[model samples]
Target: MKKTTLATLSLAMLGATGAAHAQNSVTLYGIVDTGLTFIHNDGGNGNSYSMSSGNMSGNRFGLKGTEDLGGGLKTIFVLENGFNSTNGKLGQGSRMFGRQAYIGLTGDTWGTVTAGRQYDPLVDLVQPVQGDNWLGGIFSTPGDIDNADNSARVNNSIKYTSPVWAGFQFEGMYSLGGVAGATGSGQSYAGAASYSFGQMNLAAGYYHLSNGNTLAARLAGTTTWDSLFNTSVNAAYQSASSINNARIGGNYTFGPVTAGGYYSYAEYTADGRSLFTRAQKYNTGSVYAMWQVSAPLQAEAGYTYMHSTGNSSAKYNQFALAADYLLSKRTDVYAQVAYALASGTEDPAGGQAQAVIGSATGDSGSNKQALVTVGIRHKF
Candidate 1:
């Protein structure tokens, strides 16, 4: 009888442990996107074609998990890696989890907090209302100078996100400078908010990053900012002391159609140590519409206008169109085309303002550039 009781108690304890373990969960997910691309007047090459990766979404794999802590609280973590599907090369400077790596805690009443390398608040709150959300970088700003395409990520960052209440949500983030002497050098911070009611959604945000006071840091780029300058649109301002960006966007959906637009203003400020004395500013605006032609077919069209002031008076006009056909729930094929025209004059350091379609294609080396891509994407 004693042995029987002991065995029964042991079984009960084992069952309790198993039940506890059931409350924790982990998931593996990823997206693979690859394509063939053609560029008109690519870097003076004249009609260039090549294999491209990440036409609509970056290739990535991620692990996410959560542990139930009870009382409506939980602990969560995510590790995401970005890569090039065409060459099997690691993306985001070859970091193992370059896309995102964060850990945090959340509760039903209090909200959530996380710390690590992650996207800014603007990307979290504002990007969803923009054209880039559907068509990717091809529909974004010319050089992505304002990070409208999420080309830049913050490191050593802590972020807080509030739970949705009454169709409203908000997020904020701050990155540590990690400079011993100067506390503010190389720092970044952002905040954003969104509201949705019925068929309409709106969002706005502001971001700021300090380039650090050292010339070497500016040349090599700051550790706090992953990729600040990717194209000629803002390459000349890499030596600036700081960058500031503000954006606002909204979208409305009716039946099978949705339309939205966004406006952004970015400025690179010069300090005493920089080459240019005045700030370089960019003003960009874009509008887009999407049609759900069918359950498996969708189409999108957009236009972008960018103007540069402060140090230069360059202008850019772009038109883009895209279509996607779904093969399955997790797979799709897509085609996109974009054309850009450049005008006005650029600073000597920046050379003549050449047309660059988003940040994906190379400069035209002339007044105009065009690009087309046919790609396939799979999610798992």
Candidate 2:
């Protein structure tokens, strides 16, 4: 009798544990996108070839969890990591969980609110309307000057999103300065909204960030701007006191083909300690079209134009083409080509600017640049 009672009690305890486990769940997901690429101009030298990662969607793995609370609300969390698949290097400044790391609560009616290092509203809302949305960085802005390629992220942030109502959705984000004496220094804010009607979609967004006086000027343990201008095109603006960008984009679908376009304006303002006296500004515009050739194949083409003023006067014209085949639901093979031509003049013989396509670590020897990449991508 004693043995039977013990067995029954153990079974009841196991049943209660199972019930608690069922109320909460966690999932693992990731994508691996890698490819071999060829560039006509490598750091202004000759042609070169190498293996690349994150050719389409960035290579990443993440865990997402949710605990159901009563009344249509749940606590959710996500921890994501990004890496280079070629040699296995961590991305986003070599930080662990660099792609995304956040925890939040969700409501069926109130939408989601998350706090952590995260992408701004523009990257989340406005980027999906362009060819790069489907073709990847091959169609990205020349030099990614306006972050059309999502080159930067905000740290120490709080974000709020609203549910779609009447085909419209919106979101906002703010990052703290984390400085003791300065409340506004090293702070950033962004907002975006999107609308969809029928087969057409439109989006607009703006982002603003102010840098601390100096990385060390603020405090011993405080957040500072990471400075996103690592490219050859806009490196000079890294010392600016503030940066702002405004963008608008729209897309329309017709049967198996889709057409889209966008415009962006960005300004980098300086103070007494900056390299230049005035604010530097850039204007970028692009248009693209995609054709679904078949159930498993697609082709896309895009054109981009960029102009700069203030500290320098330069212009860039770029074009890209891509074709992709779906090998399976979670795997695909793709080929793409991109080229850029730069012209104009800047004092001190800034020389005719050289073309630097997408995130390629090379610059054209002359006014023209070209690159070709063949890649495979898998997701799980």
Highest TM-score scorer: 1
Residue pairs in collision within model 2: none
Q: Write the per-residue lDDT of candidate 1 for residues 269-376, one digit (tens) a residue.
A: 998877678998999999999999999999999999999987778999999999999998888999999999999766645578889898677667888999999999
RMSD to the hidden true structure, all candidates: 6.4, 6.6
| Reference-based lDDT, residue 311, model 1 | 73
Clashes of 1: 0
Off-target runs (Cα >4 Å) in candidate 1 are 1-22, 348-350
Show model 2 residue runs off by greater than 4 Å: 1-22, 215-226, 345-351, 360-362
| TM value for model 1 | 0.94
TM-score (C-alpha, index-matched) for candidate 2? 0.91
Question: Largest lDDT belongs to which candidate?
Answer: 1
In candidate 2, residue 364 scores what lDDT?
68
TM-score of each: 0.94, 0.91
